[model samples]
Target: MDNRKEILDELSGLSPRLRDLKAKGDGLTTPEGYFEGLSDQVWSRLKDSPKKETVVRPMRRLWRLPYKSGIAAALVLAAAALIWLNRPRESAAFDLGALTPQEAEQYILNNIEDFDLSMLVASRPEEIADPAGAGRTDTLDSELDQLLDEYLEDVDDATLEQILF
Candidate 1:
C-alpha cells in the first residue's frame, strides 16, 4: 500500500542503518558461545555477594512467628490487657442499700438544689404521693413554717427585706 511505502521511506530517512538492516532481513545476533556459560557467570557474581543472617529468640513469640508479626501481636495483647484491667468492676459498685433511710433523707435535703420536683416525687412511695394520705407531709410543713417564723423574728427589718427581695 502507499501508506506502507511512506512509513518505510520515513523510517529509512530517519536511520540509514535501519534501512540497511531491513535489506539484510536480520535482527539481533550473538557469537555461538556468547550464552553457553550464562548460568555459571550469574552464579559467580552471586557467590561474591554478602548475605544477611538474623537470630530469633524462642521466648519472643508464642508460635514460630517473624519478628515484626510477633511484636505486633504482643502490642495488641498488652493493649487488650490494659483496657480490661481499667474497666469498671461489680465489686467496686456503690452500695445504695448500705445507706439508712434517715441518712438518705439527710443527704437528699442537703443536696436539695441538685434535685427537681419530679425526681423527689418519683422517689416517694405511692402512699406518700398523695399529701392527704401522708401525715409526715403536714408535720414537715408545720416544722418548716415554725423554723421560718423563728428565723424571721431574729432578723431585723432591713436584713429580712433584703433576704425576701
Candidate 2:
C-alpha cells in the first residue's frame, strides 16, 4: 500500500523488456575489425598514384616604371641653363658726361630765382615767319630738325619747356 514500493516494482519490470529487445537485434553478434581488408585497399591506391609536374617559365622580361617624367625634368633644367648662358650682359663702363646729384641740386638752387616757368606754360605756339635766313638756312634746318626729333621722342614737353625757358 506504500507509494515508493509501487514505483520500484514498475521500473524493475521495464528493465527485462529492454534487454530482451536488444538481444533480438544485430547488437548481439559482431566484434571489432570486421572490415580491415577494405581499408588497406583504399590506402594502397592513393599512395601508388602518379605525381603531377608543374611548369615554371623563366622570367624573360621585367616590368619597370616609365622614364618620361625624369626626361622632362632634365630637359627643363637644360633649357633654363641655356637661356641663362645666352642672356646679354649689362654695360659696366662709366662715363662722366652725366650730372651728379650734388651738382644738379646746386645748379637748380642757384638759377631758381632768375627763371619764370609760369610764363612759358601760358605762351602760345607761334610759327616763325621764316625759320630760315640768309646764309643761316643750314643752321636753322639742323636746329629745327633737332627740335622736331626731341619733340617726337616722347620727352615730357612741359618739363622740357620749364627747364629751357
Candidate 3:
C-alpha cells in the first residue's frame, strides 16, 4: 500500500511536464494538414528524381555495320556463286589418251598375259548325241550368249564411261 502511494506522488509531481509535452504535441495534431503539407513535397521529389533515357539505333545502320571476320567468307561465297551463275555451260569432253604423258601411258600400254581365253568356250556334254528327247547344247550356248548381251546392255552409259575412261 505504501509503495503504491509513493508512485502516485511521483506521478503528481510529473503533471506539469506532462501537460507541457501534451501542449507541444497538440500543435502537430492536424491529420489532414500533415498529409496535405507533404503532398507537394512528395510530388516535387518525384518530379526531380533522375530518369534513365534509352537510345535506339537505326535498323538500316545496324545492317550496314561491317561484319568482323565473316566478310572474307561472304565474299568467297558470293564470288563462287557469281562465277557459277555467269560461267559458260560446256558439255563434258573426254579423251583418255590426253589424260597423262608418256610415263602413265607406258604403265598401261604393256601387254597383259594373265587372262585365259579357254574358259569362254562351251563345255562338252556327256553324250555325243541326243537320241531320245535330249535338248541340244548349242541351244544352251545361244541362250548364254543372249543373257550376256542383255546384261551388257543393262550397264548404264555413265557407268560404262567411268570404267572405260
Candidate 4:
C-alpha cells in the first residue's frame, strides 16, 4: 500500500510538466498533401526512367547425354550378365572307344550296384533260349565262358572272389 501511494505522488508531481509538453505538440510534421501526392510522384519518376530489356535464353539439352548413355550401357551390361549367367553348359560326352580297359572296368564296378543280379538270374529259361532250345546249351556255355575269361583277365583275385561270393 505504501508503494502505491509513493507512485501516485510521483505521477502527481510530473502532471503539470506533462500538460505543458502536451500543449506544445512535437515539432515533427510532414509537408501538406505529402501522402496524397506520394503515389503520383512515384508514378511520374517511373514513367521518365529508361527501360532495359531482359532476355532469357533457353538452357542447352545436352547436359543429360552422358547420364542417358550411362543408363543405356548399364542396361546392356545387365542384360549381357543375365544372358551369360543363365546360359546352359554343354555336358561332357562319354566315349567308350576313348576309355582304357581299366577305366571301363572301374566304371562297371562302380555301377555294378545298379544292376539286379537276382532278377537277371531268375529270368525264365525260355527268355534265354532261342526259338529252338535243343542242342544250343553247349554253344551258349562256351560263349559265356569266353566272355567271363575275358572280363576276369584284368580283375584282381580278391575282386573276383568278392563278386563270386
Cα lDDT of all candidates, in order?
0.60, 0.49, 0.49, 0.59
Off by over 4 Å in 1: 1-127, 130-133
lDDT of 1: 0.60
Model 2 lDDT tens row, 74-152:
8899999999999975221121114364543343344434433332212211223344433354543454355446444
**Candidates, ranked, TM-score:** 1, 3, 4, 2
TM-score, candidate number 1: 0.24
Q: lDDT score of model 2?
A: 0.49
Q: Model 4: how large is the Cα RMSD against the reference?
A: 27.3
Q: In model 1, what are the clashing residue pairs, if there are any? A: none
Better of 1 and 4 by TM-score: 1
TM-score of model number 3? 0.23
Give the per-residue lDDT digits (tens) of candidate 1, residues 27-101: 669988978889899889889886656655666544554567877888999999999989985321132125465
Better of 1 and 3 by lDDT: 1
Local error of candidate 4 at 85, Å? 44
Query: Any runs in candidate 3 off by more than 4 Å, and if so which?
Result: 1-53, 58-68, 91-152, 156-165
By lDDT, the candidates rank as: 1, 4, 3, 2
Pitting candidate 1 against candidate 2, the one with the higher lDDT is 1
User: How close is every model to the real structure, measured as TM-score?
Assistant: 0.24, 0.18, 0.23, 0.22
